[model samples]
Target chain A: MQERTVKITNRLGLHARAAARLVRQAGQFKSAVELKREDTGQTADGKSILGVLLLAAAQGSRITIRTEGPDEERAAAALLQIVEEKFGEEAPDGLF
Target chain B: MDSSNTSHSRNSKLKGLAASPGIAIGRVLRLDERGRRQFYYMEVSAQQARTEIKRLREAFAEAHARLKEIRSNLKGELGGQHEYILDAHLLMLEDKHLIAEAEREIRSRRINAEWAVRNVADRLAGAYRHIKDPYLRERSADIEDIATRLLTTLSGHTRFNMSTLDQDVVIVAETIWPSTVGELDLNHVLGFATDTGGLTSHSAIIARAVGLPAVVGLHEITKNAGTGDAIIIDGAAGEVVLRPTKPIIRTYIEKRDLDRERRVEASVRSSEPATTLDGVRITLRANVELPAEIESLALFGAEGIGLYRSEFLLLNRLPELPDEDEQYQVYRKLAEATGEHGASIRVFDLGGDKLSLDGFEEEKNPALGLRAIRLSLKAQEIFRTQVKAILRANSHGKLRIVLALISTLDELRDAKRIIEEVKRELAESGAVHDPELPLGVMIEVPAAALMADMFAREADFLSIGTNDLIQYLLAVDRANENVAHLYQPLHPAVLRTISHLVRVAEKAKAPLELCGEMAGSPIQAIALVGLGVRTLSLAPASIPLVRNAIRSIDQSRVRALLAEAVKLATTGEVEALLGRQLPRQAPQFFAALSSLG
Candidate 1:
């Protein structure tokens, strides 16, 4: 298993579009990817947009990404990179 | 289960809003989710459970395919701006939690596939309901949307096969989503009668675009009618009759044929200018709520978009308004669509009965409370953002800014000050914009109407919103059933106020327009022209009939009729006079109007 913790830096955190992007990235790896919100202790499947949205991971919140299977390491890295990059969203001042 | 075969002794009639005009008589096709829920919980044996699980899987797959097709089709139509919405729906369909949970419920709870899916969706929706953020909470609607699609698929309601339907049928549903309207085959579907909807809903707009007769807000059409039950819908009268007797059906059939013949005659002359027989020219424009409705303007021979209600863009994204870029894109589209003819974009008219944003205090009477320009002035940032967008979009084509509900001169001046400030900022930033863009005031409040001469002097143009003006002038809420009868457009007081506005605008040499339900009605439209108003903005579906009415009248004669009308004491007196006199002057137009009854 591969696990890493990342902070949600985007202004509108884990919104529908952001969650969709996360799910799309998670689906690329042949691994079971899960996201656990550190503050609330809530867990959701990273590949499920609804589950990710239900996590309610707002901005400045910490979440741990876990991936297991043959491609676990790559999946964990990809999801962590997505979160660290704010899911390719522009800066806070930019229009959503 | 055989509800269609049930004896039809009780012939019921329902009254609703006239969403789209015309008539339709056919058997009903009940797409009622509530009715389907009754059979959702039926249990099954292990052997049947296997089949049910397979059925569930197939439904998910089929729904996924249909959504994919819809997404691709809409890509070209909407310029892929709303692609993310459909993308999320497709993702929800294939979500592991949704699919696996349904399968698990089917096996362990021994419930039918429909019940299992519904159960899981309800639980998730409940969770979403508890969300603290209003924007995120709104996402729950997306879940419900997908679940409805799955349920429809599992119940063998094949919305995808509507194009191949073997018989002409009237669609009876609790609510018809706009996306579903895109999938409907107009050739097979005669009309739409929904238990819930309004005249301005997206579905109703599509129905009008395709010339389908629709009566919405029937409240219980689905409960009263079933698949294959005889149904008759009179859209103009806002009447829906279920298990319609032969006489009722015959009356509607004749009315329907007359409506069709009249529509064909009107369309043939739609390209001609709306000039009175006496040679006075009148410009007819469309009141648009959505960008999708832009396509219907040219088809209806609308000169331009008169009232682009920008507030609709705020409805879906409330709590968080659409950013400047998003608003700019929509306004640019409107400007381009209208082109040289020009378009008027009304800034956010939030509050009132239309919408109450999150964190707004509950008012005792919202209609009279802080709304329109009042709300916009209070939330200057929201107002500035929309103004900035409109100004930026003005570079694309001819566009005017219209401020709504400017009851006081100070409010109009304040809004104009904000627009000027925004224009300065845009110019400083070196953004492309039209510095000469016109600013208009919507004369809706009784105070504004009484002070029309002052507003006409200050504002570049004046557009009378008769709906709210009459409601306020008479102290009658049109939406309230008790006092709705008193919400008269042709009341003597309303006519006098309008005539006052006309004289004031003419004296000021300011362009004047009227955009309200009264302008859409043939009788009231003639009265408007008679009152000296030269431009009218109405629904796209109403343009043909109103144009035909305008072409049929002699303006000088109607002006004389108006002189007699304002002297009348009551609404009934004025209505009787117009009803008696208008027919004589415009026999063909009155003939079409009488046939509607």
Candidate 2:
């Protein structure tokens, strides 16, 4: 398993659209992707939008992304990159 | 099952908001969702669990297909602008956690698929409700929406099959979503009575658009009603009678027939002008929100579209405002549809309780805060785009611009200046538009009504939006049950304020129209015409009744009645005077009104 912790960079945090993008991205890999909120200890399936939303990860919150099985390395790297890039949203997250 | 012979059978009435105008008596079809937090729960055997799982899978597949179809259809119409929201819904449907969690509950808890699904959805929604962010909290509604769809599918009442219902029935539910109303087959459905919704809710709007008799906000109609119970819905009176006695049913049938006959008579005479006996011509127009409602204008004999609320367009495409081109197309369609009579497109009245835009902070008093004209002025970019679109569509038909909630002279002047700026830009761009397009001000705010003389002089036309005016003038919130009784239309203050507006508009020689709930009622229409108002705009269904009322009354007598009514000290006195005097003057209109009750 490959795991990496990252902070929510988008101002709106893990909102519907942002969570949707993450889930769609997670679905592309042949790995079981899961997310765990650091402070709340809440865990969610990265492939489920509802589960990801259940984390309610607000801005500046830290979450750990864990991926297992065949494409774990790529899945973890891709998710980490997306989180760092703020889900390709504009700076300050104006596209509400 | 002959309940009529049983003395124990309960006969009860439910009071709710009069969402649509008409009468319907039929057997009840209680659509799923017995209550907001309650569902049909049952246990299943080990072998039956497998069958339940298969049923759930099929339901998911059906819901997935329906969502995709709706997405593609919306994409075709809106150029894929709103696909992101639908895409999110699609992803939720495909969520492994949602599906697997429900399946696991059905197996472990030995409950039915519907119960399992509801259990999982409630948990998820409960979590979402606790979310501190308002935007994230609203996501719970989406989950509930999906669960309702699944439940409906599991109930074997898929929207597609609603049309195949063998018998006509009145739909009783906790709350019917607006989208579901569109999918219902009107042929088999007589009307709707729900536990929740107000007069201006989207479901109510759809019910009006389709001409279905609906009574909402009943609180517990679904609990009192069972599938196939004898039901009667008086949409005009906002009453729902369940398991009605035979005699009550017969009386309602008579009332229904008489109402239908009167409507037919009104419709037949609808083509004639609404001229008073003394030769004053009254122009009757429609207050519409959707394009679908425009088709009923001719049927109801509305001469033109008076108040076309443009906020509906915004409501459909929320969080993201429709761009100039998108708004232009809708405005253009409205202009062309209204034809020579023209349409007055009011700028979007956002804020308040209507809709909360992304950037707007939660206000303690939204009704008195940045709403209507204030929001438009503050959000100049959105205001400018809408004004530019209205101007661009002016070339198609006789279109007028109406601004809502202009409480100050500066607000009116600023809105006019912005409109002028947009017009100038369009002119410079060589866009074909009506250069002489008229601009009107909605006299809804108390301050606006007080400054009617100045507004009438500056505005090309004036419209009295009595709904807000009455609410503000009386300091009564119509939505608050405690104070709603004080929100009277015939209140002495309301009449005097309207009388002042009419006199000022006449002095300025500006065309004035009253477009509000007051104008829709036959009794109030009489009072308004008596007060020197000549043009009235109301819902299309109300036009026939108001026209018949207008045709039946002699203006001279009503004017004399108004003279006495304005001197009354209270709403009760004014109402009593009109109730006693109007029937004598317009017996035909009174007879029709009596038939409805």
- Considering summed lDDT, which 10 consecutive residues are worst modelled in model 1 chain B? B32-41
Q: Which regions of candidate 1 are displaced past 4 Å? A: A1-96, B1-7, B10-12, B15-19, B26-211, B216-222, B244-258, B359-364
- For model 1, name the residue pairs that clash: none
lDDT of 1: 0.83
lDDT of 2 by residue, B135-168 (tens): 8899999998898888767766422244434678
Tens digits of per-residue lDDT, candidate 1, B286-320, equal 98876668997887899998998788786545678
Would candidate 2 be rated incorrect, acceptable, medium or high by CAPRI criteria?
A: acceptable
Per-candidate Cα lDDT values, in order, are 0.83, 0.83
Clashes of 1: 0
Candidate 2 segments whose C-alpha is farther than 4 A from its true place: A1-96, B1-10, B17-19, B27-116, B119-189, B196-206, B226-230, B245-251
lDDT tens digits, residue span A18-77, model 2 = 888899999999999999999989999999998898788999999999999899999999
Model 2 global lDDT (CA atoms, 0 to 1):
0.83
